[model samples]
Target: MQVKDGLTFQEVNAACGVKIVAPDLEKSIAGTTLHLANTKEQIENAETAIREEWRAIYEKMPIMCSVCKEISPRVEFIANCQKGNPCQVQ
Candidate 1:
């Protein structure tokens, strides 16, 4: 699930742990860019509130392992830590 340059859409989605439901990938890309631009403008208009909301969301997200700081889901990370396994992304 490693995301790097020159990867396919599926690869990117796998890396990000998301799914695209759009019928057309190209149109989806364009629409997403446009939506992000619009959202950026809206956020600029309400920067304080948006920033606070984002901070709350970020704080609720799963954290990496305290031992090695590896990227993984919380359950897997705990299992690795309890088993004394190396911190690796599954």
Candidate 2:
């Protein structure tokens, strides 16, 4: 496999035959000691995009009751109406 920058030691171990002992230390001293196998900027951008997408979805629909497993309507749920109907179980 191709070894790039920013890849975790565990990931590199899985991809390659080499086993990493100290992943934390290696990541901390990346570029100086251990070379990364992936781009940190790419990973951060992907994480940001995923977070933004999830935030949008959460804003659209939030407050799912664990007991009833029901999601309340946006307005009623936001208003904290105790009389709100339970959502249909999947």
Candidate 3:
């Protein structure tokens, strides 16, 4: 769950956790709002909300188009068929 600097890891073992040098790891984890997951559905419910929020954020994010090499908003890219280009290309 630690997302920093494009770094990716599947899982962290408790024994190896002691050897790692992340100063803020403990503080961050401690500060996180914890919810009691009494059932499988509860975990999925929380994760679903979190995923939706991130999806909305990514939708508004702007990026350069690969074909035209021009900046384009993600929403515009998603239009697919609709007109009125925001990037201003004719």
Candidate 4:
């Protein structure tokens, strides 16, 4: 198989880039089995929970002006701009 950069085995397999190989034997042997402990639904639920937690934290945080280093809600900053008073960065 060809070596590719920055790709997981699952990604390559999904892209049909991987080839499964086995040895030729005279007698039959038992095949390997994989048991997935976490189902797809469990993984999705975990990701959703993480995103909700982060969103809750982000909502409480104040926004900082890139020009003046002022920390406040974004709406207040926009109001200042609307009043013809822009941030002055020294």
Best by lDDT: 3
Q: What TM-score, over all chains together, does every model reach?
A: 0.25, 0.32, 0.40, 0.33
- Candidate 3 deviant stretches above 4 angstroms: 1-38, 66-70, 80-87
What would the TM-score be for candidate 4 when compared with the true structure? 0.33
* lDDT by residue for model 4 (1-90), tens: 655454335434252554444455333223322222278887687667656765665554577877788887656667777988657667
Lowest-scoring 10 consecutive residues by lDDT in candidate 2? 27-36
Candidate 3 residue lDDT tens string, 1-90: 764445345554444443344546564333233333558999898778656766777787887866567776688876842664434444
Better of 1 and 4 by lDDT: 4
Which runs in model 1 stand beyond 4 Å of their true positions?
Answer: 1-45, 66-90
Model 2: what TM-score? 0.32
Which scores greater on TM-score, model 1 or model 2? 2
Q: What is the alpha-carbon RMSD of candidate 2 to the true structure?
A: 11.0
List, residue by residue over 1-90, the lDDT tens digit for candidate 2.
Answer: 755544343434343555455546643422222333368886677667666765566566657777676676565565555565344446
Q: What is the lDDT of residue 73 in candidate 4?
A: 62
Better of 2 and 4 by lDDT: 4
In model 1, what are the clashing residue pairs, if there are any?
A: none
